[model samples]
Target: MEMVRELASKKAAVIFTKSSCCMCHSIKALFYELGASPTVHELDQDANGREIEWALRSLGCNPAVPAVFIGGQFVGSAKDVISLHLDGSLKQMLINAKAIWF
Candidate 1:
């Protein structure tokens, strides 16, 4: 989401994703299409990648493939991100997160 992008602009970001996840790929592509690049941390490739997975589990998140974060704040899954973008809420979230100027 916008908040995630803002945090990423300020510092390196970690998007915990899985290689086999379609939604995860979509999220990455969305960022690319928007001219935002996030350092993806594929969970299926590393055990520590499960940290976010565990957090999501604790937060009652579905055992999904894309659990994003910004400045250590959980930003939900790909659907949530895309939905925000569609609703124009992501822009403010990004501004509030300080990822975009204007």
Candidate 2:
């Protein structure tokens, strides 16, 4: 949990992902398209991956990989991200989180 919190607070936008997960790829692409350079943690390749995943689950994330955190807050899964984007709130969220300058 401490590691997860540290990583989350290390950047304005952070994503815990697995390399082979398509949803993770989609989310990464989404941040790129939005002009935000998010810090990505590839769980599959990390020594503490499983621990972090479990920590994320305890924090209320389901299927934890691809878990998104902005401004130290859990932003949910791909569905939630898409919804925020479609609703035009994602941009502001990024700005508020200090993830993007524009």
Candidate 3:
């Protein structure tokens, strides 16, 4: 949990993901399209992946991977991110977090 907190706060935007997940890739692409650079942690490649996933579960994230955090706040999962984007609020969220200039 400490590590999750640290990573979340370390960047304006962070994404906890698994390398081969298509939804994870889509989320990354979305952020890129929005001109926001998010710090991505590929759990599949990390030694503490299971522990981090466990921590995320404790935080109420189901399926854990592709969890998005903005400004140290757990924003949501891939579906939530897509919903926010479609609703036109994701850009503002990124701006608020200072993750994007615009």
Candidate 4:
């Protein structure tokens, strides 16, 4: 969890993912399309991947991979992100975090 906190806060927007996950790819694309550069951590490719995955699960991320943090806060998974986008809040969050500019 500490490592998650450290890594998540390293940038305005962060996404913990696995290289092969399609959902992860979509979410990353969403951020990019919105003009936000997010810090992406590919757990499956990291040395502490397994442990970090455990921490994400413990933090309530179920299947985990696409865990997202915005403004250094644990926001949620792909569904949540899509919901936020539909409601027009995701863009606001990106702006607030300075991950995107108006």
Clashes of each: 2, 0, 0, 0
- Report the number of the highest-TM-score candidate: 4
In TM-score terms, candidate 4 sits at 0.98
Clashing pairs in 2: none
Q: Is candidate 3 or candidate 4 better by TM-score?
A: 4
Off by over 4 Å in 3: none
Can you write out model 1's per-residue Cα lDDT over 5-98, one digit (the tens) per residue? Answer: 3433454334668899998899888765654556787878976556646755675558656866654566777778888889987656655654
Cα TM-score per model: 0.71, 0.96, 0.97, 0.98
lDDT of 4 at 42: 96
Write model 4 residue lDDT over 27-70, tens digit each, in one string: 99999999998999999999999999999999899989799999
- Model 2 lDDT per residue over 1-102, tens place: 999999998899999999999999999999999999999999999999999999999987788878999998889888889899999998899999989986
Please identify model 1 stretches exceeding 4 Å from their true place. Answer: 1-13, 98-102
Candidate 2 weakest ten by summed lDDT: 57-66
Misplaced by over 4 Å in model 2 are none
TM-score of 2: 0.96
lDDT of 3 by residue, 1-102 (tens): 999999999999999999999999999999999999999999999999999999999998898989999999999999999999999999999999999995
Comparing candidate 2 with candidate 3, which one achieves the higher lDDT?
3
Lowest-scoring 10 consecutive residues by lDDT in candidate 1?
4-13
Where model 4 places Cα greater than 4 Å from the true spot, the runs are none
Output the better candidate (2/3) by TM-score: 3
